[model samples]
Target: MVSKHVKRNYRIVRYVLYKETLLNTREHVWSFLGAFCGIGLLATCQGVWQDERLTVLLIGSFGASSVLVFGAIQSPYAQPRNLIGGHVLSAVIGVACQQLLGADTWYAAAFAVALAIIGMQYSKTVHPPGGATALIAVIGGPQIVAMGWWYVLMPVLVGALVLLVVALVFNNLTADRAYPTSGRFTRIIRRRQQGGRGE
Candidate 1:
């Protein structure tokens, strides 16, 4: 004879707990390894070049990128094109905003992120972390500002490529997991399987 309120609360709690449970422990482990190696390699490269330390290596948005690229492998936002194009385009827009409006101003930071979102949407590479990438350009201090357009190539493009490589290797190690779960790679795989089956 549980009260109706008590039963409703129990159902809600059960639903939340179920959603929070991990479906596969091995997938989580692979995701952890991919992010670790990817970011580690980028950081190591930056550390090796003492002069570029300030402008190269890690960016805060990369951490968010790792979560999507590794943990959420099936998400369209985590796909290779989105990860690379989103960050590169956002960085370019961010640098432009900083140069035009000056990095110190609050408006510049806000507008950079807003414009980045619009650009990513238009480009069909709408990654959530690109907003942070855009904001970092506006507020990343003198070192980043000095790098200018170079920032778009180095930390944005290079770092993303490193992550993608690591994800491809690590995520595919498991039979059930496949990196770049959609797009051209998926099509190629589907075609191969169809050919194998003689369909």
Candidate 2:
């Protein structure tokens, strides 16, 4: 049996913590707007950089991935290194999986996405689009498989590099944000704790 006082206290606490603690700084505002601009750039590029070799939809989705990269929305999954390497690694892995398992249908696709997800988590570069990038390798069929590991070097790696360059420019132009915010700090701390004993 819950008392009215208890319920009221809960409500007041929630309001104070969740609602009253909101912050809306200028940096936050610019990061939000800058992400939209990055989205637009990627969308426009889809029309320009596309080839009919693959379907129209996949090309366009590169644009969406661009948003994830440049958005600077403070997601672990969207940082530049993750944005690039996660997808490239997953794409390469997916293609290899397709070849090994034979890309006939559901199982291979499932394997691709699951492996990609797990791989990203392990690597700590869990970009959301990496799942799609891996699936793209499977569904893209012979053309992708034919790239012979170079597929990642092309659209996956190259595309992410371009997106990162763009993100660097746009995300910095506003003067309120920066990225790759020192995963190295953790590394340094760990090394210090290990006391120079690593082989």
Candidate 3:
């Protein structure tokens, strides 16, 4: 009685709608607050110390990092090690590429991004935002180039650590939410659960 194509389309629509309803109000609130506080702190510090005309505190890649660190809290890429290692390594590679190949060149930008990806992958800290970090170093104008190696410490490392701390606080506020879904934190969570059950 029903057409196969119609049934297939209805199934696809239902699947899409189901996925959309997955994130509830509490998850949304936590994600928003976490990102806001993390980025806000970085921006406030940058504004206080750096010249108003220059964008020093927050890098473009960090925006992408916030999305994963806050929104997709469960993703492996959002883990603390990945977040820090990826950005730091990428920044180092990017600065090296810029210094060796000259900034503002397409070849340097491409090579930096490519090498960053390889480094992240081999290092087992594959965060997607690291690509942007590498590219920014290649063409972030004079200010970023000026910072050079210090860029790895300030914007990349500091920003990531702030986000990780925010995520730890915010995500753990709800009993159902867990941050740093692996490593030491995961073991601690398991111990707590076992202890609660008197195991």
Candidate 4:
């Protein structure tokens, strides 16, 4: 006759342990390498352009992007559509908010992030870093604000593409890891394989 409280405590402990499961050494190494290469490329670009008086290719949001694409590749938010679509949508919304309401107003910043989230949700691209991209557009210093719409094309869109390219390469390097856990890309890949087999 076990006590009910003891049984409940045991269940809770089991659940906690399950949730805290750790990845193997290989996963960690791959994640590290992927993130290092992804950001390293952007950083290199930034270094090369630092003295050019032009907008650099790096942004803070891409760091968060790396966490998802490299460390949590299986996350829906980390998939190709979310990674690219989310950042691009958020950048557009953020820039619009800044231009229409002016970054000086407090509500403008809030609106930028809020609307960006809505946009991502409706578009089915809910990458978390997108929120940061929106906020950066609002609160960013003169250099960012001055870039105006160009900001989206350079650091936001271009930077995301760079990271995406890296994720595509590194995430698929090993047999265990595959990018875009599921999506149109996966479907296309399956179709191609089926076609090859039939041929």
Candidate 5:
């Protein structure tokens, strides 16, 4: 009695949510711990270390990074190289665009993100947070720019390092979890060299 389209939709939903769904309480504990640590550190730093107000973007980055890194631990997307390189590259590109593009607002924002993504791809360090880094740079006020590249090193790099360090410890604590993939791509390259067909 089921229509074909309805059957297809049901299958899609099941597949999408099936294995990835967190039915186990242990899974929730690990995932939440990663996310909480990242955000908590950032939040604590806001008032004590720096007077800057926490923006939605920074908060979102902290939360999303945790999810990407811990929640999907096996994914190449969350690897340490991708996490740090992507952000650093984007930060540099953003500063360069701000200097060269002359604050055209929308143009700078758009181009910085696009360019940063392209750069990341070429560098083989594609991470989701890099986009935000670029956007931050383009729209960042004079004070941010005045920080003169040190801003990238201080808050961005330092924050990411702290989050990553915490994830490394917490993720590896459980027998089932592994933190910051060691060298997946290297293994793949070795396989390819040995004639393992991959497309």
Candidate 6:
């Protein structure tokens, strides 16, 4: 006789393996397009706005965010609130850590990331890329250090918005892919469509 615990363990193993073994080409294509457009838009902005006083429109953390927001659209971390709030909050913490501890020390970077994680958790917007966003503020060189509070507005918030917009558009192009699995906006849109059909 199989014990219930053993059976449950076997089922879990099977589920994990099954998920890994499956291939979804359609899903991959959409993820690719979404990530490409999201990052490409930021890159284009950086190129267009380059000048004597360079505005940093692109940040490395956005690459990690692209993986979640586009490739793993259904994840809670990839949602609009998480994507935007996490980056913005983390950037604020990062800037504060740099200011308080001085960006030159390694501990400042560690402290920035650690505090950012706590901030995200407490705020209910735990996006993994936010850790990197915090670290970047500490070690991102003179340009970023110089930006100070402005970092939250430009590359962090602006870049996050761009990614969110692209994810919302491309992820909805296919019937199977929904950028946000559930949200008030989705409900409102559906209700309006139903009303329009009745009319």
Segments of candidate 6 deviating more than 4 angstroms: 1-18, 52-54, 188-199
TM-score of 3: 0.88
Scored by CA lDDT, what does every candidate get? 0.86, 0.68, 0.86, 0.90, 0.74, 0.89
Q: Report lDDT (Cα) of residue 86, candidate 3.
A: 96
Tens-place lDDT per residue, model 2, 32-57, is 56566555554556567667432122
Judge candidate 5 against the unseen true structure and give its global Cα lDDT, from 0 to 1.
0.74
Clashes of 2: 0
| Per-residue C-alpha lDDT of model 5 across residues 1-199, encoded as one tens digit per residue | 5698899999999988995574988977998887787778777766565443222224235566677887887888788988888888888888888778855568888898999999999999998878878777778676666654665775667777877887777776665676666667434545544563445
Reference-based TM-score, model 1: 0.88
C-alpha RMSD of candidate 4: 3.3
lDDT of residue 82 for candidate 6: 95
For candidate 5, give the lDDT of residue 61.
51
lDDT for residue 87 in candidate 4, whole number 0-100: 99
Q: Which stretches of candidate 1 lie over 4 Å from their true place?
A: 53-55, 187-199
Q: What is the Å distance of residue 77 in model 6 from its true position?
A: 0.7
Residues forming the 10-long window of minimal summed lDDT in candidate 3: 48-57
Against the hidden reference, what TM-scores do the models get?
A: 0.88, 0.66, 0.88, 0.86, 0.78, 0.85
User: Positional deviation of 149 in candidate 1, in angstroms?
Assistant: 1.3
Model 1: per-residue lDDT, tens digit, 149-195? 88888788888888888887777665567778866776665566567
Candidate 3, residue 56: Cα displacement in angstroms equals: 1.1
